[model samples]
Target: MIDIKNLHKSYHMGKNSLHVLKGINFSVSEGEMVSIMGSSGSGKSTLLNILGILDEADEGTYTLDGTLIKNLNEKVAARYRNQFLGFIFQSFNLINYKSALDNVSMPLYYQGVKRNVRTEKAMHYLEKVGLADWASHLPNELSGGQKQRVAIARALASDPKLLLADEPTGALDTKTSYEVMELIQGINDEGKTILIVTHEDDIAHMTKRIVNLKDGLIIDDSKVTQVRAKAENYV
Candidate 1:
């Protein structure tokens, strides 16, 4: 679903230039779950930003879901992002004042879905993430795991082709992280392509493939027997 080759990215700070991604290359097929692992200052975040079309690369090619991605104006980029990509962030970026159901339905509202249809779809996804009963609660009233579940439901409400999660379990305890990964695994099993950017080794292991990055390049890319995260086992 994603094909990137010779991608290069750099940032200019006054007269100094810092190269973030150096000729990165990778492809992810539909129904595959992959993790990008790296330490601080690695190019994982740069690569992900490029993949999400949040930032443009300095050079090279990125083809997502078969369309070449480059030089998109902000409006076009926003359109593609809404149509094809779903994002989950470390911060669980939910509206603080909105109820869980309203948060989940916000994306659909932006997409111009009718109010009733959007609410129905949002509730369905909230139920999928085991948060149906919590739909009326605000983010402040929910636990970290509950908030993240609502965020995941928000991401899924649009039925995008790819899901990009940046440190999805970063804020939670170990048991909660495991529960979240278990939910993510079930999503992948249903044929959704996912890419997780995480520094945690255990988190990377939960994915079917791990791609190691260092000094702006991919050092290792290999498939492994997936480690299933069972909430019960963690508890």
Candidate 2:
């Protein structure tokens, strides 16, 4: 579902340039669940940004689904992002004042979905994430895990082809993290292509494949035996 070749990115400060991604190459197939792992300065975040079309690569190419992603204007980029990608951030990124239902429906609203239809879809996804009863609660009113669940619901409300999660379990406790991973695993089992960026080894092990990055290049890309998160124990 994602293709990248010779991907390179750099940030310039004064006379020096910091190259974050250097000659990166990888492909993620439909229905695959993958994690990008790296330490600080590894350029994994930069890679994720490029894949999300939030930023452009200085050199190389990225193709999402079937369309080439390069130098698009904001309007076109936004259209592709809405139609082809979904995002889950560690921060949740939900509006403080909006209820969970409203937060989940925000993307659909941006896509011009009718109010009733979007509401129905939002409820469906909230239910999928086991947050149906918390729909009326605002972000501030929910627990950390619940807020992330709302974010996941918002991302899925679009039914996008790919899901990009950045440090999805970063802020939660171990049990909560497993709970969230369990939810994510179920999502992947249903055939949603997922790419996660995480520094935690245990978290990466939950995914079907891990791509290790260092100094702006992929050092290792291998499929591993998936370790299912035992959220049931925590519950």
Candidate 3:
């Protein structure tokens, strides 16, 4: 679903260039769950942002589902991102004033979906994530785990082919993080590719494959372990 080659990104820090990513390459197949694991300053987030198309790469080629990313104009990139990808962030990124239902409906609203259709679809996803009862509540009213669940629901409401998550479990406790992982696994089982960037080992273990990044390059790309349903742990 995603093909990346020789990706490079740099930031200016007081006349010095901070080269975060240098020649990273990888491909994600449909329905695959992958993890990019690294410590701070390892460029994992830069890679994720590039993959998510939230940021552009300074040097490299990225093709999503087939179309070359660099070739796209801003408007086309936005539409492609909205249509094919969903994002979950560490901050939850929920509108402070919007109810859970409204937050989940935001993506569809941007897609030009009508109020009624988007509302129904958003509720369907919220129910799938076990947040049907919390729809009327605001983000501040929900627990950390509940807020993350709502974010996941919102990400899935668009029926995206890929989900990009950056440190999704950072704000939650261990137990809550595990529960969030379970929810992510269930979503992957339904055939959406998932790519998550996290520093937590347990969270990395939840993915089918782990790619270790260091100094802006992939040093290890291995199947650490197969992912299992939370009901029956992996053998």
Task: Please tell me which predicted candidate would have the highest lDDT against the true structure.
Answer: 2
Each model's Cα RMSD? 0.7, 0.8, 2.5
Ranking of candidates on lDDT, top first: 2, 1, 3
Q: Estimate the lDDT of model 3.
A: 0.89
lDDT of each: 0.94, 0.96, 0.89
Error of 3 at 209 (Å): 0.2
Q: Please give, for residues 29-133, the per-residue lDDT of candidate 3 as tens digits.
A: 988999899888899988888887778889889998887888678888899899988999998999989999999999999999999999999999999999999
Write down the lDDT that model 2 would get: 0.96
Tens digit of lDDT per residue, candidate 2, span 50-83? Answer: 9998999999999999899998999999999999
Give the winner by TM-score: 1 or 3.
1
Which residue pairs come into collision in candidate 2? none
Model 1 C-alpha lDDT versus the unseen true structure: 0.94
Give per-residue CA lDDT, model 1, range 142-235, as digits (tens).
9999999999999999999999999999999999999999999999999999999998899899999999999999999999889999878765
Candidate 3's C-alpha runs over 4 A off are: 227-235
Off by over 4 Å in 1: none
Give residue 20's error in model 3 in angstroms. Answer: 1.6
